[model samples]
Target: MRLRTGDGGETIDRQDIDVNQVRIGLDLSVPARLGGLELTPSGTVHVRRDGGAGQTGDGIEVAVGLRAVLGTARLDAQARTLAHHRAEKATASAAWR
Candidate 1:
């Protein structure tokens, strides 16, 4: 995904792909904050099969994310899970001027 802010601001873009034997997927997110806070989240899922003409196999994936800002502090959280495996992570930061 690609993101752009106002003039004199900044732009950011990111992409991710998973190359595995069982599953393959991609995810992208971009967000900008002016005075308060901004949040954006997105993801995708794809499953591979042993032998098939078109897309096959029972592929299942889920993603959860959140972004928040209070005063001079900001927080973001994200979680992802595929098949039977699960993973989660979070981050918190602050700024002052």
Candidate 2:
């Protein structure tokens, strides 16, 4: 388990509207070994309050990921969803190392 808190600002579009937020996030992970491979699965939830000229209510984000390692090779994959007021987005990614 993990916890985090931070603050940041964003400029929207070309209108120069500024939005500021205080953010919080929590993460959880479980790791185990299967045969010759090591596996870790994790999830996180994040929330933030929007304030300032471009404020649009509140926002939340959720993500899940998995990582596997064998010898010197590793692979990771993750998916995330973010929602803020009338805006929403989803993203996914994979990486090998």
Candidate 3:
């Protein structure tokens, strides 16, 4: 249970919402030449329902990604896809002193 307030300091209840979600993930570590690499793979299933009506949506997502650390440089990449959507992201950064 949770409580929320508006600008006028009025209490609001959100117990009317019913939601279900499940997530599973796995991680692996492998030795790298300079540093190390971590492999992460995961999946998720979720559904939301409104009490007032039958408004609802369900989605499933799967993603496999990796993060690599080499000295002062860091690299990350991930590929994800959903039952109705798709997304891919990557990042790289380095620092010098």
- Highest lDDT model number: 2
| Per-prediction TM-score to the true structure, in the order listed | 0.34, 0.63, 0.36
1-97, model 1: which lDDT tens digit per residue? 4455665545355544333346566656666565666655545454433224433334346565666666777787876554432223322222222
Q: Please say which candidate is ahead in TM-score: 2 or 3.
A: 2
Runs with alpha carbons beyond 4 Å of true place in candidate 2: 1-17, 83-97
Tens digits of per-residue lDDT for model 2 on 1-97?
A: 2334465555445565577877799999999999999999999988866677753456677789999999999999998876433323433333432
**Each candidate structure's count of clashing pairs:** 0, 0, 0
> Where does the lowest 10-residue lDDT sum fall in candidate 3?
85-94
Model 3, position 88: C-alpha lDDT score: 29
Q: Top model by TM-score, which number?
A: 2
Candidate 3 off by > 4 Å: 1-15, 34-60, 83-97
Worst window of 10 by summed lDDT in candidate 2: 87-96
- What lDDT score is found at residue 48 in candidate 2? 67
Collision count of model 2: 0
